[model samples]
Target: MFKHAIAAVLLASANVAAPAVAQPAPAPSTAQAPLQLWRLDCGEFVIKQYGAFFSDTFQYPRGPKNIVGSCYLIRHGDRYMLWDTGLTDALVGNTFDNAAQTLRLRQSLVDQLRQIGVRPEQIELIGISHWHFDHTGQAGRFPQARLLMGRDDVELLRGTPSPDQDSTDALAHWLNGPGQIQQVSGDHDVFGDGRVVMLTTPGHTPAHYALLVRLASGPVLLTGDLYHFTEQVANRGVPPFNHNRADTLASMDRFDRIARNLGARVIIQHEPADIAKLPAFPQAAQ
Candidate 1:
């Protein structure tokens, strides 16, 4: 039915005749620039009892769950923007091991970027999902880039004795001086053309954000710890450590509506399954 309807529209358009009057030459086109997106592996962690970490109400079945960490590289025209920094480079060789969790990075983010011919210096903007260690770990490596993060999350980092010492230390350059930083209060159109946007969700953290990348293939939504796993989306599971329960629920509602309205391909950042939505590393989604 859909194909036939499209065919009918094409047939009707083909039947139209050109105007008899001569028209002036058209000016140079000013269409929106094209975009490209690439997903890179930052790290992975395994929780002994994933249910306890991702839910406040025992929503998920008790068992080990390996959560993957990811970082994204976006190219808008000639400029490049990086989303999230993932785990620290220090984790490349050593692993953070404990009874509750084990975290490690298989490769440094810079190394992965190099594999795809992107250098840390080439990235002009770094948009962070939130002020979490796992996400801000390697931000310092890109000191030349302007950092974009939630306003509240920036304030948290500015405060004395930050809650997450690792993140605070990693982002010290942005907090103190030298490095540029932009504290985002609401949804931010990164490139000003609306092709890329940072959706302010703010439940997992005070200023958490989900990224929306408009690719030629489709609109892709990157969930920033909004739903750790697919099951969380079904049960509306809120992590016990989330900043606000009510805010989380509201953000989830907004996220869902945006995804449905845009018919976006939603990729839960930490979910291994969602990570496979895009082409493998080194290949971009254009």
Candidate 2:
């Protein structure tokens, strides 16, 4: 009986040792690929004054101001990616003009791309910060480009009704077309590394996102309406017109932390001052 008990104890010991012996080693963390950031001027896209609420203020210093629109050109190896599409010709009607003085409205996105020698067909990916009509107006131009959008934004785009009712028919058609659409639920590593990451920051919209680009100049955070201007970031102000005030504040806090941690430069999409600071595309010539 004693011998049998000893045998059983040995068998249990062997079983424990087997697992330790078979345990696999941990995989190494992936190294981030090198990346370059290019600031593409999509001519001048206009934004109606008070079109976007900045903090508690609905109107700008100058009543009903129109602002220039700028998009990004991100180059990853052989492929080129567009951060957002600018205004479409459809937006040039009297209604848009009457809303605010034309601060700056230039050529269409297609025309701008042509001027830069980049065809719409050459664009591999179009990553939208949100589903706003102004930002997404020219998305349909690149029918073959893969559309990357936040998952929550996708639901909001796919006929999910919101009281805002700011949806554009052209945007809806573009999202539902034959082109491939990739939905990201949370923070995404675009290059399977930390180089170009898409962080989910919901506030202005349920699916608002920010892009973090690890550039040679250092890290750069492309804030898409999270804070319309630097003053919003400075004051930690939440815009009056947001889906959720609390969520918006929290998102701002996150942006602060990220910018500090990465020592990144935060670029506000609509802020004219922020746009003026950055070096334009074709960096060598500039």
Each model's lDDT comes to 0.86, 0.67
Each prediction's number of clashing residue pairs: 0, 0
Angstrom error of the Cα, residue 192, model 2: value is 1.2
- TM-score of every candidate: 0.88, 0.78
In model 1, the runs with Cα more than 4 Å from the true position are 1-31
Q: Cα lDDT for residue 89, model 1? A: 92
Tens digits of per-residue lDDT, candidate 1, 1-286, equal: 0000112122224556743444554422225676889998989999988888778998777889998999999988889998999999999989999988899999987898899888889999999998889999999999999999999999988888788889998998998878999988888878776678899898889999999888878899999888888988879999888898999999999999999999999999999999999999889998
TM-score of 1: 0.88
* Model 1 poorest ten-residue lDDT run: 1-10
Which residue pairs overlap in candidate 2's backbone? none
Backbone clash total, candidate 2: 0
lDDT (tens digit, per residue) of candidate 2 on 1-286? 0000112222336447553333343322223344666665543534444535344644334335334566787777667788877655555432344443343335566766676678888989888888776677677778888888888777777764643244445455445666788887778777654567788888788888889887766778888778766666767766565777777788888988999987888888777778766786545111
